[model samples]
Target: MQDIIGRIGMRKAALGVLALAGATILAALAYEHIGGYVPCELCYRQRWAYYIGIPAALVAALFVRSRPALAAGALAVVGMAFLLNTGLGIHHAGVEWGWWPGPAGCSGGVQVSTDTGALIESLRNGQTVRCDEPAFRFLGLSFAGWNAVISLGLAVLAGLGLQRFARRHLAAV
Candidate 1:
């Protein structure tokens, strides 16, 4: 896998990263909109990396040939974003597994209202999703766990591609 990644040029690698990030975000949106899976606060937060990475990958791809340094920088940023996202995924997964508690807002809670009207309104607007619970799990891994795996893979790919670009272009400069 490392050899294959090392061999893929900067532009191709950037495109690959873009494709993967796009597909993952699209899948998450589909799960939420089409499949009726409501995302908790953390689930929504986990998407930040993909949102940032997609454009960065595109920029990297576009500038790869014209300005290799700029492309390398963009790819490095994408790699770092994915790496941070991987940590977030792992934290969310741990929360789901009861290894640690989730945030106060996302973990399970009800707002106290003394007024009858306020109570009714609060009930109507209450949060339905809890970050501590896994909405779905497959192969002993929840969505968060799968996200961690995918994010780590993306980070590694970006890193490998950056390394290759540096060797081929930066080293020559």
Candidate 2:
């Protein structure tokens, strides 16, 4: 692990991880636009991690050469994003597997409003996508399941980046 870190350098690895997040986001968009898969509210929520991680990765990579402490902080944020995404992905997968219910808004539960006109408007503009249903599966894994797997991997990579930064900082000290 140390050899790999030394060979690649944390900055490059951070950039690579950021690119992976961006590519995954693009793939999600493609699945929605080109493959005609409509995203549920949970699906949209799952993307927040990647959206945040990409920018954090950029900052980490940029500052790693001159300001490693700052880079470490940014990498920590990236790790947290992926870690949070992993939990969310697991929850979404469980929802699809009937292990638990998703958010009321996306799980097909009807929300009653005191105002009839507001209720009527919500009904007209409400989301039709169901978070409990998997739009498609590959190798028996839903997209949420895949996201959990990928997010766990990203978390590990971020950990490695953090370790690298720590080692360098300690050595300098």
Best by lDDT: 1
Compose the digit string of candidate 1's lDDT tens values, residues 1-173: 76786788778778989999899999999999999899999999999999899899999999988888899999999999999999999999999999988997778764566999987886789655889999999999999999999999999889888888778776767
Q: In order, what is each prediction's RMSD in angstroms?
A: 1.8, 2.2
**What is candidate 2's CA lDDT for residue 106?**
77
Native-to-model Cα distance after best TM-score fit, residue 73 in candidate 1, in Å: 1.2
Candidate 1's C-alpha runs over 4 A off are: 1-3, 109-111, 115-117
> In order, what lDDT does every prediction score?
0.90, 0.87
- Model 2, span 1-173: residue lDDT tens: 56876665568768878888888889999999999999999999989999888899899999987988888888889889999999999999999999998888778785678999987887798557989999989998899999988888787788888876677677778
- The clash count of every prediction, one per candidate, is 0, 0
What TM-score goes with each of the models? 0.92, 0.88
Task: Identify the candidate with maximal TM-score.
Answer: 1
